[model samples]
Target: MSRRCELTGKAVLTGNLVSHSNRKTRRRFLPNLVNVTLTSDALQRSVKLRVSANALKSVDHRGGLDAFLIKASVDDLSPKAAELKRAVQKATASTAAAA
Candidate 1:
């Protein structure tokens, strides 16, 4: 797998490392990705994802995985996260329709 965050689409960023002598070297600024199991209240299941630290914090701030996915924009999310967002939307819609 690539060094990418599944939720936020965060990946390795290329930049220059400058020294005191004015010399520059190529360097990578990688996202802080971690494997986590998040439970979705809408789906009533646990899902595993490789997400960046910021994304995890956002999920918490949004209340849960389903809430985060529902509020997140598709352009800023990875393919997997987009799919999960769709699933969450569908589940919530079904629940609402049934109620």
Candidate 2:
């Protein structure tokens, strides 16, 4: 669909391309977006999302999908990701209550 990262909200940025003669032309800087299936330990399921390379690394650094989504900002997450985050939160809360 769109050229945007669902996790980090990384999108295409407009900039200038300078030639050898120092002439500037319009260009776009695209995010390195990739489709990945990340598993959520809280939800006990895997979800596929389009995310930037940096976001993928962040997810790994943070531990897993549920961990990353729990700490992620609502403004940066896409609609689908936000929904997933909510679901994970609910599941985690219920598990905490049960324990």
lDDT of 1 by residue, 1-99 (tens): 999888778899999999999999999999999999999999899999999999999899989999889988899788888998999999999999999
For 46-90, candidate 2 gives per-residue lDDT tens digits of 899999999999999999889999999999999999999999999
Off by over 4 Å in 1: none
In candidate 1, position 46 carries an lDDT of 92
User: Which lDDT values do the candidates have, in the order given?
Assistant: 0.91, 0.95
- What clash pairs does model 2 have? none
The residue-level lDDT of candidate 1 at 96 comes to: 99
Candidate 1 TM-score to native: 0.93
Give each model a TM-score. 0.93, 0.97
Q: Which 10-residue span in candidate 1 carries the lowest summed lDDT? A: 2-11
lDDT of 1: 0.91
